[model samples]
Target chain A: MADAYESLTDHEDDARWAYGTGFSDPLAGVDTTVPSGIDHEDLAAYCLMLGDDALIMSHRLQQWVTRAPETEDELAIANIALDLLGQARLLLSRAAFVSGSGDEDSLAYLRPASQFRNVNLAARADADFAHLVARLLMFSSWRLALFDRLTGAADPVLSAIAAKGVKELTYHRDYAAQWVLRLGDGTEISRGRMRAAVGDLLGGSLVDELFAVHEVEERLAGVAVSPGGVKEEVLSVWGQVMRAATLAEGVGTTAPAGGRPPPGPPPPPPGGGGHDCAGGAFARAGSAFPRAGWA
Target chain B: MTSAAASTAATVAAGVADPEMPMLTLGDLGILRGVDEEPGRVIVTITPTYSGCPAMQTIRDDLTVALRAAGYREVEVRTVLTPAWTTDWITADGHDKLAAAGISPPGPAPRRAAGPVPLTLVPRASAISCPRCGSPETETITPFSATACRSLHRCTVCLEPFEHVKEI
Candidate 1:
């Protein structure tokens, strides 16, 4: 082994070490070509929406690092956060690549809160453990559904990223669901808190924004998975998890209005009219993409 | 440096052992992609097993020092993410090294077929043989372990708990 090491490392000139320092481009050899008919600017904006969501949520999860109830839980939450950070890194990089300006770090750190496009659910302040679990359950379910569809995307990079995300998000969703079950069925106080969390955090207008389609999503057509398309799948899975926990669907004090479109006609694409979210403000901006809704 | 010299440099870098799993070198783990020789610097490419692996910095530093000690003046390490690293890349020697170190090696990569399936309620344990007693009658203590690639398990025959390298 020492001989092998000597032979491999003895060169005076710059030679590749098995491992080296500095940043290596994760998408080094990936085919980053945007699909035909897909606008580069639209793709970049869409990536920001997805990447910002992960970046913000990862930060939230990081807040739990040393404060979790158990050492194992701390590690698990940290791992989940790291997973989201990884996804954010990739998506942000892709956005940079598409836009022809900025990089992952710039897009992530330099952007102001006003420029952020993540949903409101991800941006809220850290809540109690039950609230966090409830939020995670909903977020992971929705993201998993989106990623599952994104695996078939026309863009190879997006497809590859989604393929990897599916596994990680599966575990993430499972972790949150398990916690929901434990807390909801654990004790009277625990159950009450869990119930309040789901009703307060996930029940109202918060979820409605997740299903609203933006102009970027609509323009991408077959290239991007629309939030509205995955609404049923996301809701069904969430419903099953809640039912198993013995929590009533839509049991919050507030009416379950705003998040999802009513039984009638689909509201015009998010920027159409009377869309109260910040997304409308973004749409009014030079960019075709609408700003994402917040909590 | 000549092509032969570059290959030699890569071999040396590959020999550096992983800080977390010392028995297995980066080469054994298949993370050492290649070594490129430039005029004044050596660039090495590697892929991380997980995004937040704590050992990556250590491995990077170790590689730089190893090359410097071997007479190389400059070294640069690059980490990539695309074509994500998989457990299936562990070399045959790597598996043996893991087992000898009392860590059960991983099985094949998990199958990810298209379309949805029922959510997995119970955390599934891979059918891994115990490193201590080679016992098949083992049970998973937890789905997670100290590291992202491992899980806690105990051999039924030996009654000794051990770490199993989880299939990614």
Candidate 2:
């Protein structure tokens, strides 16, 4: 509306919001001039990895905008998408600072596909309804675990983002877990498809475990984070969710190797394949549906 | 940076707390990021808690009226999409407000999340202890609050039901 007006001068000179004054630098409590004793580049890159994952996932989730199976589901999906978008914004901003480049909007809209560092899981489009549930359940479990660890990161900004993310991830996990249980325990058709979906998660390259924090972790020693290390804890909780819901436990109980450093980038995490249009990963698996035909 | 203007403006802001979580003012929620006055205009900048919070419009409208009622002419409010707001922004006072409102605020905003405490889970603080009874025995009957500000929680110890301000 302001742009449609006669001149740029007609619009208010202030960049601040007129109707929504919610983002008043919530980090006012901390000395945000710079994170204390942390490598900005590594922190920024780490943030990008997490941010891009959330951004892509949010983009992918937006496909369900009006096509959700039910009205409640539509709201739920939008809610989840918004949550992801929120994470993306925070992470992207953090990354922009680290990289000394553009801010969130510039990075989100300008970056090409390959430039994005989100694991394949986030980039993968929405699959069939059942597959979407599987991907969400798996991805949420993994990310929730990662964010859970990031809440203790050495960087104040990253810690702040992670602290906020814990709430959102908890919701995402709960929502996806509920869907998995419903589909797994519902009708015969639902049950069968759910089984296949769960089975697909077993060995999709992400089977071994993954950790991209090598540079960051090594630098900060105790400050950096590794999603790969918490694989067991995450899987254990995820397994319980599945078992409690009566789904066929495709994964066995993993022993708790708590506090061990994660191995090298082990494949991508779950959700890295099934709907990957970029890589040839699941090209042959489910031609039953086109690549995210939701549109 | 007029002290008189800021004091009056802050009072107007005092009327504007988070719509979803009424216990904390927008200032307390850390969502009411910054306020600026130029010529005859007042600009209030906000960051949405989530992209599609159903009450965003309500919050927007309330900000407008709150500023106008506070006696600011040509008031404007805008929502910033970047630097997403987080639970860590919830101030210590905000936590107290949530607790007073019967919602257990998030545990201390993780200081060093890279190696945070393991039992990490931050919900809406729905598992809040009852303000009346101080028991960690509460249940959320409805996720969405009646006023888009408070959820209905029933406490077991006091056998009393109350409204808990939903945490952002």
Candidate 3:
């Protein structure tokens, strides 16, 4: 058997052993023609929205690498982060290909925070493990539902990406859901923390933004999934999981009145209106296809 | 080029082992799609196991090296995305190879129905047996493991920890 680890040290191109060291095109050699009737600009913008979400959320998960409570948890979080990062690379590459803009690196790193099109939930720092799992449970469930529908997207590349994502997201959503269950039912202290985490997220306006309809989603029709459409099914699944874990009912389905809102939304994208997903100023306030990133 | 030349290139490409799971060849792993030969150039097609699979680059490099050493002037590795890869593609021989390496081979890939995927709070019971003791009484230690494609598990009878290739 090849000593895979040992061989890495002796390999001539040892510098390229780790991920991110050598940046080859993730979608190299695949036919990237935009499907007929799909506006390339709209498609590129849509890719940024989804790609930015995965990229930013992946960053959030990566923060847990060395700090997770156990070695197993660290591995799990790191793997999940890697999956999201992989999805981010593909989506960002597609966006760049369609937009005639910079490559994935420039789109991911060169842009300022205000230019990122991710939702507020992805950008927030996890207060603790409970908060992390709570956010993960919601994020994975929502993304899984969206990707499930995207398998039939009008764009073949998007459809292919979503098809592959469905399998991985299945594992991700289940991982977070199981953690919520364990933490929510473990001990008095653990249950309190889990409940508080769920409450803070659900009671805030950021959760509502996940379900809001964005203009790009409206224009893309069959090619994109409106977050609003999947909200019901996602909530239903979350409700079942929360109930089993003995958390409060009706928490994440909706937010309470006078709840805390995120920061204000950035100015609309060029040629777009004032229909940003986040109503107020949030660290990341752009809608699904907000033009702030482009500006 | 003659079919004989293409056959030789295919044999070389097929023998390249996976970087992570060295026991399985690229063919056994089901990532190698096709091998075509021209006068002085050969084109090889492969599909990634995952979008973010880090091993893809290494796999490409390994295939190119193996083919070039076999007297090919040039080698081109292409990737395909349609009909995304599934663990079900692992050949019958691949399953035996994984078992021999102390890793549990995946069972049949789950066939999904049309519409929304149902959410389950707990893991669905899978028919995975221990590779070492051949005991069926094994439980998953964690769904995520050393690699994106595997899960950590422990056997109750033999009490040995092993990795199981996930059924995607």
Using TM-score as the measure, the top candidate is: 3
* Model 1 C-alpha lDDT per residue in residues A137-251, reported as the tens digit of each score: 8899999999889878887778778877876788788889888888877777677767767776654466877899887888887668999999998888888888888776545
For every model in order, the fraction of real contacts preserved is: 0.14, 0.08, 0.65
Q: Which residue pairs collide, candidate 3?
A: A263-A280, A263-A281, A263-A282, A264-A280, A264-A281, A264-A282, A269-A291
The alpha-carbon RMSD over the true interface for every model, in angstroms, is 4.4, 7.6, 1.8
DockQ of 3: 0.62
The candidate scoring highest on DockQ is 3
Q: Rank order by TM-score, top first? A: 3, 1, 2
lDDT of 3 by residue, A1-295 (tens): 8687766666566435643247688888888999889988999989988898888778778777777888888899999899899899999999999998899999987876667788777765566687788888889889889988898899888889888888888888888989999988788777766776787777666677788777788899999998888998988988888888988564444332323232123222212323322323323444433432243
Clashes of each: 14, 35, 7
Indicate the TM-score of model 3: 0.88
Task: Give the higher-DockQ candidate: 2 or 3.
Answer: 3
Candidate 1 Cα outliers beyond 4 Å, as residue runs: A1-37, A248-250, A253-295, B1-10, B32-45, B52-82, B125-130, B133-142, B154-161
Q: Which is the leading candidate under lDDT?
A: 3
lDDT of 2 by residue, B1-168 (tens): 566787677667656866566667887877777777777878777766653454555566677777887788777666554365666777788878877766655544334344322332223445567777888788765443343233466888898877654454
- Compute the lDDT for candidate 2: 0.61
Candidate 3 lDDT, B1-168, residue by residue in tens? 449889999999999998889999999999998899977899999998987799888888888878888999799998888789999999999999999999999999988887678676878775799999998999888888999999999999989999999998
